[model samples]
Target: MTLRDFALMVVVCLIWASSNVVSKYVVSHLGVPPLFFAGVRFVLVALATAPWLMPAPKPLWRILAVGVLMGAGNFALLFIGLKTATPSSAAIVSQIGAPLTAVMSFLMLGETMNRRRIFGVSLTALGVILVMWDPRGFHASMGLLFVLAAAFLGSLGAVMMKQMDGVKPLQFQAWVGFSSAVPLLIASALFEPGAIEPAAAAGWRFAAAVGFSAIVVSVAAHTAYYGLIQRYEANLVSPLTLMTPLFTIGMGVLFMHDPFGPRMALGTIVALAGVLIVALRFNQLVSLVLAMRPRAQ
Candidate 1:
């Protein structure tokens, strides 16, 4: 991990974090339809990365499935959630994807779950519950529920991706863009009638947001992150991504005026801590977890 690479990773995290705020603004504030917004973003992503689609990965069916799950399914739900969920709370809730991936791996990939991982998973769930707690009950936080579902789909896609081979980041992005765009566009047309009107009203702002999200965040930042993954160890790179939600929470406060009371703060800390635990490798994780336990006399 050179200092430059670390800086690059931080930049990548910032880009990703800003995306939440951007999406929230476009959907919640600008009034763009969520499915329509996601569909257009993927359409642009597909065009940009279309060249990489060649020499397509095998098991095309699985690739398509992963694409829809990670790309359209995940982001469509996220945008929908952002319609009502603040970026700050949504960011904290999204951290559940890390532990969800771990659990999915255990269930689908025959992976082992040690004490640390189990504890981490439990903590993550607890944190999400705390963050989602509403005195007004579930109806008030329906958006967060959608976000949770999105996280589950994304985690499932990640677990499925582990079985894939020879799929470069750009190539994967290309497939995801193409596969996700079709269904999303169709769904938007069907369910969100006159979706284009709001986008038209938004004009260049909408185009700019979608372009930034598609090209810069999805294509460029993700490709750079994947390059780092190839260069560095996964455990090292993975934990650093926790910076994303922190950045999102900060940006949400500064830009969106999102409320951040004590409960939200505590939930963020606990959720991020759990994700950090889940991201750690076996040796480091065991040592940390063991240290936390009371010493026997």
Candidate 2:
């Protein structure tokens, strides 16, 4: 990758990480209902990518399912989780998606995981246990369950994503936007009475959060990240993107004042290492270790 590509990758990571902090503020601090916020954000995304909605592409039902599972189920749960969960912890827990995707791929697509990936799954489970080892008990931390559910739904979306064809970048966003928005809007209305007026009057920070998420993170950052994926090997791209959780932790602490303890620190290290293992191809990983070894004289 060139310096420009590296910089773009950094920008994408930063945007994604920062969006978590912003979402926490919007949903929790501002007291805007979580599903409502998600609905409005998707509205912005839908408008911005409206042109892509025109074509009735092949595998239309799959596209709609992917959109609902990913854009709606994933974000709705994540936003609800953020209401109680810290951004830093949410970021780490959400990474369970990688392992979940591996499992889904194996079952649905008949893909096989190597021994390294199996080890990676074990490591990820250990890391999660460490991270969630609150003396108070994890059952009370229902927020973690919500995030994990989101990760599972997202993994399903990824598996279904493999089935679709001829979907462009903006078009994918279009499907996600439309499919997620309507359901979330209905949910918000059914559950959150008198929400709209307060949210509308919440002023600029709320609007700013929505804009940053819909335009910056969902649109600009995703486009750049996807471009990098197109250009680079998946193994290389996946590991580098791990910077997102680290960046999220940093933003959470610095901006959102989220706590970071010893267990969380260790868990972050272990989980990220496991994800790296899962992401890299077995042969590529072995080659990387060999290359890094000291050369004989």
Candidate 3:
């Protein structure tokens, strides 16, 4: 990747990290119904990207399936999980998606992973197990499980996306928005009784959070990310996103007053280390090292 693309990836990570915190606030703090919040956010995304929906990409069913899996299925579960899961922990657990994506790519996309990558995947799983471990047992486990399921859905969608063609970022976002919004809204109405009132009571804060999530996160950050995914291998792009959990942990502590005990810290380090190892090819690692060295004087 060019330096410019690297910087852009960093920016996207920040946007995604910020979005996690904001979503946590909306669902956990503001008491917005998770499905409702997710539905509305995607509704706005659909409206914003509606223009790009035209000349709809071929294999319409695949596009819709990807939209439902990555967009609605992922966020719906994630928001629901966030109602109980802390932003920091949720962020860490979400990293499981990288390994999941790697596995899926290997199985579905004909990608090959050597023993090093396999070890990295195992290490990542161990770290996530540490993070998900709670002495209290089931209290937080259910929420984390939900997040794990969300990651599975998202990873599957991403791998499926790799098989697709001619789907621009905005166009993909448009389909995701539209396809996700309808089902999410319907589910919210059916399951989350009195969901709308609390969101209405949240007033402008709710509006602002949804707007930021829809416009900045789903549209700008995710669109840029999709473009990068198109331009590079998934493993190459996935490692850089480790920055997101770091940013989330900081913001969660500073803004949301999230607890950061030694266990969580260690888990974060281990998990990130594993993900970094899994995602970086030896050549990429060498390049990164070379890039960090002093330039010719």
Candidate 4:
């Protein structure tokens, strides 16, 4: 990668990783309902990109649909997961989306899943189960399940996006922001009832989170991510994104001061390893390395 691309990757990582810590802040300090927070974030994002929303979506609506699932549904669920789950745990669960996408492609798109991919996916699921099964607290249940749901929706959206063409990332994000916010607001209203009032009472701290989430996390991070996609193949780019969780785990530990017990540590490793296997089989790794290696004289 060029220096420019490398720096962009770091920026992408920072934006993606910072989201976990910021979401934790919104939930813990502002006491905003997770879905409501997400709604606010997407609404801001939509407004920011409103000028671009015109222009024919046409067949591109299919691609925009994926963005909705990924941007709104995935984020909404992830925030809710964080409400009761640790940032580290939520990071790990979100990684499950990669493996889930692979499984989904095989089922929905009729893609062939080699044995390595299958094994990797299976291990990934097992790791998630172990991490979620925290003999105490809300483990193996709401906290874990919500994050997993986030992963599933995100993965599904990714798969759908892959099949479409011609939609720019910014355009896609704008549509996603609009599509996602409505459902999120409805869900927040029904479930949390007082969601908006508390956020209003809290004021700027909550407002800052919404701003950061929309401008920095969504726009900046995703723009960098899309730039990377322009330079690299999806397979190459996607696997490295797994690193986001690691960064998230670190942020959770250092900034949030969330627990980093042996269980969480072990679970993270196992889950990451599984996701790697599923997403980047040994053969793919070998091919990538060989491609990058200098040719012999």
Best by lDDT: 1
Candidate 1 pairs with clashing backbones? none
**Residue range with the least summed lDDT across 10 consecutive positions in model 3:** 135-144
Candidate 3: C-alpha lDDT: 0.91
TM-score of each predicted structure versus truth? 0.95, 0.95, 0.92, 0.90
Arrange candidates, best TM-score first.
1, 2, 3, 4
lDDT values for all models:
0.95, 0.88, 0.91, 0.82
Q: Higher TM-score: candidate 1 or 3? A: 1
lDDT (tens digit, per residue) of candidate 2 on 5-113 = 9998998899999998999988889999999999999999999989889796677789889999999999999999999998999999888899889978998999997
User: What are the C-alpha RMSDs, in order, of all predicted structures?
Assistant: 3.8, 2.2, 2.4, 3.3
lDDT of 4 at 38: 92
Q: Which parts of model 3 are misplaced by more than 4 Å?
A: 1-6, 227-237, 286-297
Give the clash total for candidate 4: 0
Superposition error at 179 for model 3 (Å): 0.7
Off by over 4 Å in 2: 286-297
Write the residue-wise lDDT of candidate 1 on 53-146 in tens digits.
9887889989999999999999999999999999989999999999999999999999989998999999988899889988778788899999
Q: Give the worst 10-residue stretch by lDDT in candidate 4.
A: 135-144
lDDT of 1: 0.95
